[model samples]
Target: MGNTDKFEMIANIYDTPERIQIAKVSSDAIRECLVDAKSKNAIDFGCGTGLVGMNLLNDFKSILFLDTSQNMINQIKQKISSSNIQNAATLCFDFEKDSLSDLHADYIFMAQVLLHINDVELVLSRLYEVLKESGHLLIVDFDKNEKIVSDMVHNGFDQIELTEIMTKIGYRDIQSKTFYTGSKIFMGHDASLFILDSQK
Candidate 1:
């Protein structure tokens, strides 16, 4: 299935307690690396149901929740309406298809989203384009795993390899560290995740 259709099917069940807790963990990791956030614009590149992004609204001047699935964006909109949130908006957009040249951001956060993409380099290039000078990109994804296997998803990522790729894409001051591990966290098997923090 395409990214949109696959996420649309799971939008209803995305906010399970387990997922919410995990998202909190991820957001906390991202927050630790953020500096001067209150005056900046940030985009949650794959914000599903606004779990982490909404929690981070207080930190940024504006937060754009971007996702491939309209259904996922719908959930974010509902939360926005009920909570009377300000400085936050949802957009159903595909990173692969849409030109992000018009949208520049000081920070971008992607949690558990990159593994689903088949072309990592292309997406990273696009992210670099949209980032303002000296902007940061924080990516939360699984560390390399040998036990899990799937054609539709990357088994995991190698920190050194990813860093090399990011550097090649023109990112600077890149750093990565594993932050969380959970039982059956990914694909019904135990997994650990790393957060990659880099400057454009």
Candidate 2:
């Protein structure tokens, strides 16, 4: 099965303790980069079961939980319904293939999502078009690691290389740092994660 199929199959059980902890840390990192965010609208791009977006509901006026898996979107919808979360919405979308021309946001953030994307630059450019002027795009993903090899996903990303791509895409104020390290995080090997902040 493809990666999207895998995510669909696991959506109902995706929020394991380890994943939740990682999401918490990722959200914390995203929070630190936020500035005057409460009044802004945001998109939790590639949000998986709303794990990261759930913790950030109060940080933005509204958060659109976007993912390619319908099941994952359904999982987040259930959470929104249960908690009466008025500020959260969900969208099942594949930016790589589809065009969402009318949709836009003040901020866009994704956690561990880029690694799954086949065309990183294309998706980033699509997101750039979707972001409002002066909007921010925050990314949380594992740093490059040679220990983990995968055909389905990128092993990880190089911050400098990623920054260069963002710069070429016209993003400014790009900054990134390794914020967290954990065992058995990327694949089965220990890995470090970085948080990157860039402006459109």
Candidate 3:
């Protein structure tokens, strides 16, 4: 939610072929890490247009598509309405600015969302509070990219450092892997993505 205005402006055209492909890969990576998900409810934090979360609807009992930009939430809402998806919902909320104490979930997965958060540890801890006991938090993001630089978003993340932060925040059974690589994915520089799985 760091660059809220940019995401709000691009919400209408966010679902490009490249992004769809990346979403598919990210969804697949998340699917592999799911266990007994059919009985669980999930939160797709920073869900952009519901691309990745839409692919995963059938895997979970319900999914809350959450984002900071209202336009992004509207886009996902339209998709849910047009498809008559019963198990999906959307919420336009920023974890950085506010906290939702009653919003609990069996699992929470954020695809390419962590990099947009300015205070990563604070957000991660907030998400940890929202999780049900023993719930899972799957994060799909880029491996640290030295070539790409920007003030709007993180260049990427280093998995080991991230794991340490999460571990410090009380996450366990953490595991991560680089799952996909694509051209000009991060700030016009070729980059690989990684998926990190941890339990609360």
Best by lDDT: 3
lDDT tens per residue, model 3, 9-34: 99999999999999999999999999
Q: How well does candidate 3 score on lDDT at residue 146?
A: 87
CA lDDT of every candidate: 0.91, 0.93, 0.95
Q: Judged by TM-score, which candidate is best?
A: 3
- For residues 41-111, what per-residue lDDT tens digits would candidate 2 score against the true structure? 99999998988989999999999999989999999989999989999888888998976899999999999
Off by over 4 Å in 3: none
Query: Measured by C-alpha RMSD in angstroms, how accurate is candidate 1?
Result: 1.1
User: Compared to the true structure, candidate 2 yields what TM-score?
Assistant: 0.98
**Candidate 1, 1-200: lDDT as tens digits:** 13667889999888988899889999999999999999999999989898999889999999999998999999999999899998998888887775766899999999988998878988988999999999999999999899987977898899999999999999999999999999998999999989999999
Which of the two, 1 or 3, has more lDDT?
3
Per-residue lDDT value at 72 in model 3: 95
TM-score of each predicted structure versus truth: 0.97, 0.98, 0.99
How many residue pairs clash in model 2? 0
